[model samples]
Target: MKEEVTQNYLEKVKAQIAKLQSFSIVRIPREENIEADYLSKLAIVKEGIIPPNAPIRYLELPSIFALDVQVQAIDYSNSWTGPIVDYITNGTLPDDNVKARQLKI
Candidate 1:
């Protein structure tokens, strides 16, 4: 339903553009467009000054711990673990495979 409405709006815009005597869409950079640059800065300042009655929505971001890769879930019994574990656990490198060859590395 939303897609149909968007498609209709786009078709109307295309028809309008086609009917125009001269039509050219040129993108002006923010630095080149002084009016738009000033408007954007003004909008930022206006948005910052929130009204007393207006409800402000605060988005709660997910924890970094949740995004962290699960080391416990990964099977490390077969692969190199002695040196890696030693470095992690006791701050010492393994005698054999000093460099842990993993898929991520």
Candidate 2:
């Protein structure tokens, strides 16, 4: 019964996608879909549905371009630090004595 319901829902989604003028459907491995699955689980938690355990997997996409220019700029500007050991040894941000300013719109 559950499988039937899921199949029906997937069929409806496919039909709707077909009706769209422009779309690209990309199949990704479960490992590659972890981020989206995590967000969906977070949404479920927000809606008051608690799951048994937190998801353990993570997906990272290094090659795909992001629309956020600020993130891209930060990625380009930052120098690559070797590992967590390097960070623990040397990384430093602004101190509390320095006043932080928020950008105004």
Off by over 4 Å in 2: 29-32, 36-105
| lDDT of candidates 1 onward, in order | 0.59, 0.52
Question: Model 2 over residues 1-105: C-alpha lDDT tens digits?
Answer: 668766766776687688799988788876788766666677657665655565644436321222333334233224443333333555533233232121110
- Candidate closest to the true structure, highest lDDT: 1
Can you tell me which runs of candidate 1 are displaced by over 4 Å?
A: 31-105
Q: lDDT (0-100) at residue 25 of candidate 2?
A: 70
In model 2, residue pairs whose N, Cα or C atoms come closer than 3 Å (at least 3 residues apart or on different chains), thus clashing, are: none
Backbone clash numbers for all candidates listed: 1, 0
What does candidate 1's lDDT look like per residue over 1-105, in tens digits?
A: 668766766776786688789988899999898666666666567667643444434447423213434456765546667456656766664444525443114
